[model samples]
Target: MSPRPFDHVVGKNLTSVKFPVVAGLPGPEGLKTHLRGHLLRMSNVGALRVLVTGATGYIGGRLVPRLLEAGHQVRVLVRDPAKIRSVPWADGVEIARGDLTDAASLREPFRDIDVVYYLVHSMNSDGDFEEAERRSAENVASAARDAAVGRIVYLGGLHEHSDRLSTHLRSRTQVGEILIDSGVPTMVLQAGVVIGAGSASFEMIRHLTNRLPVMTTPRWVNNHIQPIAVGDVLHYLAAAATAATSESRTYDIGGPDVLRYGEMMQIYAEVAGLARRRILVLPVLTPKLAGMWIGLVTPVPLSIGRALIESLSTDAVAYEHDIDAIIAAPSGGLTPYRDAVALALRNAENTEAGWDGAAADPLPTDPAWTGEIVYTESRDAVVRADPQRVWEALLHWSSRHGHWTVENKQEPTLLELHGPGRARLQWRIESVTPARTRLHQHASYIPKGLPGQLYWLGLKPLHRIGLRRAMQSVIKESEGRR
Candidate 1:
């Protein structure tokens, strides 16, 4: 098959022209074409205004900042305002509370937007995701057409061949078609497993290798595929909007080399410093079994895991090398799998700013369990002091004690606890209803500066006792009354 024609090349800027699209944009059919031209011209100045859907999503979160950096005014379409608030540019972005399934909410966000990125997909929408995607696409297309939006950009799955497209891939393609059918010039960039921090595919590899000593593989593990770095993917997305000529094109973008899933796992294991274990692949290890095993070990939700594994039967390696014709070679070129893994780990090391990471009150030791070098304890404590007193105790819980740290593969540094002397108690006492104050203690140790019980799992009994005493000394500080 001929490689899909790239309507525009890298660095080419697309401006709207007077066409049938504009002529048809009047009634319920909408004066979308004409409006698109005007909106494009209005945004062509130094500051182009772009609206991004799914701002809180993995791709959306990273893509928003990239757009802003490229000198575009970015607005986000979000279902829930609170979720995207933690984004670094939270204040800068204009958030519109809209859902793809509901066309009514889209009109507000679609108004006066020059380019719309339809990055929203309902993978977890439950029961007929295809229908959900179709409806969402139709709704967005209608709204964009009505609002006279131009240049819809969609990021889709890498399809080796149209005849063998998986349901996921097919639905994604259909979504792009729906947008194009709206008479809006659209550019679709399809890519395979995006390797980067917090990406589902990368996380699957992280947890699977970290938790399991040996993997019982499936047949799909031998399927050939090309994985692209998330950074590269972001570059293409940004490049797509600026390319003047590349409208109404579908570009299959991927890494330089194609490797089987088994090789991919081996590369990951090497980068992670894991043991080169025997991967016993049995023909009978069906997709169902593989999905169950993945769910057991990885952070991937079962439903999504199953869908992902089931789709692995076909090779997703890109056959078309058309992307090279449009854009210049990236400075770093295509990222190797091992290099990608290392970068992702580095990024994971700095995820403290994530909203889900804030600490609550500390508690007492409950039932405890110890891993290879990590110890976990759960406890509930009722202190007679005020919440402020409890907070002080928890904050300083490791101050006087030996810090618990875990020596992992990446760095022989701390896993959970912040460095000593830097731990500050930041909290305000809410309404103190009663004399008894509640506390929830959650302690984590990094294996550098401090010694905690969890970090002594494989150590000698004496070392474990010594560490426990050190920790207890710190916990004792909180026992004092307010």
Candidate 2:
């Protein structure tokens, strides 16, 4: 770590940001108003050159855009840059090809970077994951120091110091220590279960509460937890990159409320309009059994779910709020647990990421089971005609002048319609060859409440038949055309 600690965490030589203390407004929300307003008013917007790892991940995916929004020049390092090519913000940042476990691959990405966001630590890595993470951390620490990177910001799991810490939390703590001691200033933010759409924690709670009105067993659900929203995490991360700071230390970050894991699940049900759930904790249910149960209920893979479930066995409440000294709470104080859940619910249906400032929309990489609950029926066919012909046929068949109107379009390739009471129909024209085109038609209905649920149940069979006929008609029309 740097002498007297803290590089203001951005560049070799940089002036620390100074903000006017907000007063008289009262409470935490008032205190939060100063930092953001001051930063935006700065003459130097987008001054820092930042590099981010894990660009495709849930948190990193959301943070990159915020950094860009702050007027900072951002670069991302990924093994396959193509993974992020379809993202709306893909073209806005520089891309560096690299692998974390391989030290040599990080050199170019770390070069001339003002701050390095070490956002990745994966259990999915081949062989021993602990060793893999240790190697990855060592590689990042060495590369950043060699490049004289101003600071390294890492996100770690929040847990108390104990001999009984789960393997997941222990590995995270080790990685944080390695970066802090790398002789480069580092800010390790240890956060509890992250609450957001597509986040594993949120999805785990979502499926469990949504599917099982009455859950059988895990005593871990009674453990205390202090989960934070993804938005707040991103806020602190984006701020930490440029804020005046001097510690190669760990900061515990979490939401305002401290509730039991089961209480958190019930809160989720409240926010989502679901009935209050009944949780029956069975002390005899082992972690392995709990993991298998979660696997059966949720889309999160067994490997990840197992680790997450194991960590839940310990209380995860934050030990301190020392981070407020460096970066203020996100605009309106820290997000309360209930509001965070509500925001995540809103994010579930938001196709555009961050259209709402606090919305952490689900990413393409999120499990297919995550996001808005929509009943869908789709059909596709290969027609002996060009895309234009198929598209014409698609448009003709989709037409219902009084009931449907185009929602979005992309020439002869895609057409989406919105109408007939929240139902969405879309067509895609793909050119398989000069004379052959693949036409796909999809119908999706997003149900709102009990009535919406019953509506789908009643109309599902009719929907399947109608969708099949619609695609057949389009394919026949296009194929029969000259």
Candidate closest to the true structure, highest TM-score: 2
lDDT of each: 0.62, 0.78
Cα displacement (angstroms), candidate 2, residue 31, comes to 36
List runs of model 1 lying over 4 Å from the truth.
1-36, 347-468, 474-482
lDDT of 1 by residue, 300-344 (tens): 777667767766767877777777776655686877766766666
TM-score of 2: 0.77
Worst lDDT window (10 residues) for model 1?
Answer: 358-367
- Candidate 2 overall lDDT versus native: 0.78
**Which 10 consecutive residues of model 2 have the lowest summed lDDT?**
1-10
Per-prediction tally of clashes: 29, 3
